[model samples]
Target: MPSAQSAARPAARSAAGVLGLAALTLLATAPRASAAEGWSLAPAGDGRPSFYAEGAPGTVLQDTVSVTNSGSHPVTVRLTGTGTGTGTGTGVPVTFAEPTVRVPARTRADVPFTMTVPAGAAPGDRSGTLLAKDADGRTATARIRLHVGGPALSALTVEHVAVHGDRITYDLVNRGTTVLVPKLAVRARGLFGRVLLDRAARTLPVRLAPGTRTGLSEPWPGRPALDAVDIRLTATAADGAHDTAGTEARFVPWGAVAGTAGALTAGAAVTVVRLRRRRAGRPAEPPPTDTYTDRDRDTDRDTDVELTGAVR
Candidate 1:
């Protein structure tokens, strides 16, 4: 006859398959000491169903997992780890001292394992599953969460800013390790330094996760139709992270401006020419004529007569 542990493993494996990809919390079976069924698995703690550990990057954390055989037979099982979801990405590496172990009926086996955080791991939380599979394809699982320790940073940036129609679009990026709820402020100036828009910062509806980039937009219902404009945006987070960006736009009535300038130049030229012509048309004043006295003419005639007689 099969041992109690051997008979229980197959039934457990079949149950795990039917559960499908259930969440981590649902995967925890009964505690090692309180197994009501053929076999069970859990964290080494007396009351805890899952495992939680914290360490810095490049550090190795040690923990224990327990497999309890409640049935009347012995069971052999294999151990491994599986990523829960794409947490802080690729998941922290999990390794076991003994990959296979045998648990006697009504006995529990405690296995030691190491979770090594990668040297390049970002400061965040990651999750995985500690799985125990028996020879008969039955399985039991425990959830494990590892938190990489570091300073929480709130760096953020606004990028790819542009104006399309009456809307202003941009990309929000979280450059630091912490989650952020950002607030935005907008200001715009028109030709001659007129303040066209000045809106104070307001909380955004969405949250930004670390190392994530999301596109967002602001409305411009009062956009200028005939002036050059400068638009600026400022973003701020609760943790004092802030950034600013700007763009320029121009709206012009080309036809009207060209026509008006041409008309004014033509009128000024005509006025100048008319004024020059009037100055040229005026005649010069005649020189004052000296009254030649009768006496003077007689004297000149007598002198001329005397000169003529001498020559003869």
Candidate 2:
């Protein structure tokens, strides 16, 4: 038979072994509880990637954002909208039906929002992002694009045209509502109907935004030195935007021109004086003879003698 002390020792060892097994199980499951699955936030539709709305200025557009909790606990998020994409700023007006939303575990919450196009907003495409942020600072973004309804006019003009030595400078103004990548064609004609420069339409390096003006220049390295030239520039953009402007420039070597003019004036004066002297030194012609009979000849001699005596 075993001793009583040996029996007690085996019982104590069994209790310690059971306690260690319980500790191992708790350690394995604690991390899983603390770090649970996360949630997702996006547009509400089943197959939609983002939200897009179109309306005129001062119109209100509505959309929904879906917050889904895939973890085993509820999530709370604060929502906001900010302007994004091409011609919008971050301060666009956006209002949420529920700024703070609570999504239950393994479920989703759809929140509605309205975005109003400004009363003075120009006609074009604007965009923004719907932002959802949790207390833990985790963020999700849904994109939104809004197209303002109006007549899309593509108007542009080339202004302030000037020629500076070997370059042509001008300003491009976007008169209507839209962006423009302008194509420029330059033509020049000199005196005597001669074509000095002809350049085909080529795209410019700058982009013009709606209601914006940009200054630009075109190089004219091969300009003529002695002629009056008419420089014409035509600017065109997509959607039939067109404008043309012209400038006239005259180039001359003043010293050479002045010298030639002086020489011609001096030669003309000398020729005039020579012609006057020749006319003054010429002799007069004698009277013509007449056919007369002998009796007529005798009467003419007597009249001449009487006229001489009366004069004496």
Q: TM-score for each prediction?
A: 0.59, 0.58
Pairs with steric clashes in candidate 2: none
lDDT per residue (tens digit) for residues 1-312 in model 2: 221111232343355355431110111111111112387766654446666666677776665666777877778888888755475222346788788887767777767567787876667777677778888888877666676777677899999999987999999998887778999999999998799999999999987877889988999999987999999999999999999999999999899989998887777677656655765787864553575567877996997677545433
Question: Once model 2 is optimally superposed onto the true structure by TM-score, how far is the C-alpha of residue 23 displaced, in angstroms?
Answer: 58
Q: Residues 1-312, candidate 1, lDDT per residue (tens digit)?
A: 333333243343344346431212222443332233488887654457687777788876766677878888888889899865344445658898788889888787767677887786667888778888888888888777777778878899999888898999999998987778999999999988899999999999978877889999999988977988999999999789999998999977779899998887787677667755765896875554687678877996997677545433
- Misplaced by over 4 Å in model 1 are 1-37, 45-48, 72-92, 97-107, 124-128, 131-140, 252-312
- Relative to the true structure, candidate 1 has a C-alpha RMSD (angstroms) of 17.5
RMSD of each: 17.5, 22.7
Best by lDDT: 1
